[model samples]
Target: MTNAMQLNLTTPGSNLTSYIATANSIPMLTAEEEHALAVDLQENGNLDAARRLILPHLRFVIHVARGYAGYGLQQADLIQEGNIGLMKAVKRFDPSVGVRLVSFAVHWIRAEMHEFILRNWRIVKVATTKAQRKLFFNLRKSKTRLGWFSHEQVQTVANELGVKPETVLEMESRLSGRDVGFDGYQDDDDDSFAYAPAAYLQDVSEEPARVLEAADWSAHNEERLTQAISTLDERSQDILASRWLSEEKTTLHELADKYGISAERIRQLEKAAMQKLRSALMD
Candidate 1:
């Protein structure tokens, strides 16, 4: 089963095949219908119009999302992200642009899907800038020849894409690389010492100085909090203890019952205690 839970705002248990079938079943709208829906959504924020416009084109998003299935991501997630882009495009689409809704939506759909791909494409992001994003898709397409690009070909791509040859080379390098396992162990190979992410990447968590700094920071914050709490009045301190410091926080009504006061009084006391605590902490 395709993981539909990864998607957003789509029907439950809706697979790509099912989504395609449903969307394709809806006839494509004429220019008049498409324009009317776009105007309703863009001018009046008619959610119904938005839904109507989006429903018919959902399959198109799924089709485009299918093309990006090679990135080892959940298909439903890509479709979901594409759906968001489609909705955004629908909201901004100007019917007077002399283009079909599909043409306008295509850019938005691909943009959202591309963002999702780059963010989750690897454990670490491969593309952080517009140029890198362009390189990412183009580089993948360029790799269709089944070998690395020659220096001359790299220069050609660089010139055509209006980027430095080195930038093209760098993006290509990042694209060709795969995520390495941090630990040295591998299930496929018994050789425990070979092909480890730990070997190629440094583990900052292992640094004693950094570890100590984090520990010290946590300890100091705890001490400061204790000092701040001590500065509060007896009633305010007790209120804080009962409301927040306890393992089971006391609700306003519960505290009010204990204090023989209204819930509003308890709330006021709680707010005043928080203000005092904030001031003490700031000092």
Candidate 2:
């Protein structure tokens, strides 16, 4: 069997025979060696000792990272991130606390994996806030079956997590839905895996009556605007042009300078012009 296949056969994260055999052929550390190395790294910041302590834990990080495979990140990359977290935990470890390095590092490992998963969960993240993060991780487990979470099951989870039922339901809906391809290739048939946004999302164009109504309303508004513009004095029209219709609309100060008036006077004129336009449009 290949080395990779052989590696896969062993329990993940615990036995690093493949890595050990490949990297140094060193035996796994005893509890004494492990503690001593952790203490050395923790106290003196010995990077080499830290590397030795963390190398064996690489397999463990891979094991935890594996659980997040559904996120679709490369396993190697996830393991790399988890290894970084493990190294950080080792650096900050308090050996006097009487906890094994593994126990302390597990949080760091999972934290890294969680970050990887969150970042890679979707092209656009499905989770944003802290509660959403919790929901994102727990909602799948919250499911009692493959299809949907029943109301009671949702309530139970909501109570356990101390979140509102509506929040739980919204998250559940998001989880149940999936990302789909926007469009298929040219050769795609009816059975092809395309999900055009036009097909699934609300199509405003589909309602011809609404479309016609919108068009008519827009045309009517334009007519009213033209009529209003016709009614303005030549000076007012010119001021409106430079002030409102230009590529870079003139500021009140600029308009005041041009019209030889205070900025506040310019603002009043602009407001009056807008009010007339509104009245004309309403009519």
Candidate 3:
């Protein structure tokens, strides 16, 4: 396929799933059919024949894009870059090269995707990161050993390298660094890399399942408590409410006065109500 034959088979604003579906709908090309198409395009400059050749292999671009999913960029974007590579492959597909279009297209596909990833990766790591990387390389070359530099050594290195001591320390810190996942947790299913603040721009904490479980447990306990309170007699319920559930708890003497009984009698009633509630809950 020539430049004239590079059709935008993928419609604008199509998502990854729909894009994959559309690519899959195009029938694949056989060796013989591919050879004929190449010859037709080369000899007669047949754009229709070129479209047929290119459209069918869009799925192949997606396949290559899948290999780069670990980079955490948009799959659709990677595939789109790979499509450019595919078009270039189709354009340069020499039948005399004696290889199939797919066999030849692999290089072009990976090159495009890699270039895209590196470009965006630099956007994440352009200014300070780039400088730190350069500093890291230079310092590593100048160092004599693989150990941490002493304070005196750090000053010596800094003065020698014509940079501030803090810059030297910063690069040293970076040398001991590791790149984190762009979206923090590696276990996230959907893409959350779209909104990267300073915290998650590199990586952040994992999922908080324990907090959720605690909340659920609290709600469950509240429900069971309501059910248990429903089983108490009115007097026992009033004693439990006044002595246990009120904002200001009632003393045993106060509860006794309210129930027209001795303090020891109110205590017995309160203890019995607690037992009944506990039994209901345990059931």
lDDT against the true structure, each candidate: 0.78, 0.72, 0.77
Q: On residues 122-141, what C-alpha lDDT tens digit does candidate 3 reach at each position?
A: 43342245566567667877
RMSD to true structure for each model, in Å: 18.1, 15.1, 16.1
What tens digits encode model 1's per-residue C-alpha lDDT throughout 231-283? Answer: 88888899999888899998889888888999999899889889987887888
Q: Give model 1's TM-score versus the native structure.
A: 0.40
By TM-score, the best candidate is 3
Report the poorest 10 consecutive residues by lDDT, candidate 1.
1-10
- Residue 134 of model 3 has an lDDT of 64
Which wins on TM-score, candidate 1 or candidate 3? 3
Q: Return the lDDT, model 3, position 104.
A: 92
lDDT of 1 at 192: 54
Clashes of 1: 0
The deviation in Å at residue 28 for candidate 2 is: 2.3
Q: What's the true lDDT of residue 52 in model 3?
A: 81
Clashing pairs in 2: 13-59
In model 3, which runs have C-alpha deviations exceeding 4 angstroms? 1-8, 124-283
Q: Summarize candidate 2's per-residue lDDT along 1-283 as a digit string, tens digits.
A: 3545434422334444454344333346788888898788777878768767766666677668768777656666677678767866887788788888899999988876676565566633667766687777777666745357778887888998888999988888777777654544323132555556777678777599998999999998788788998887776787788887899887878778887999998778777877887887677
Clashes of 3: 1
Best by lDDT: 1
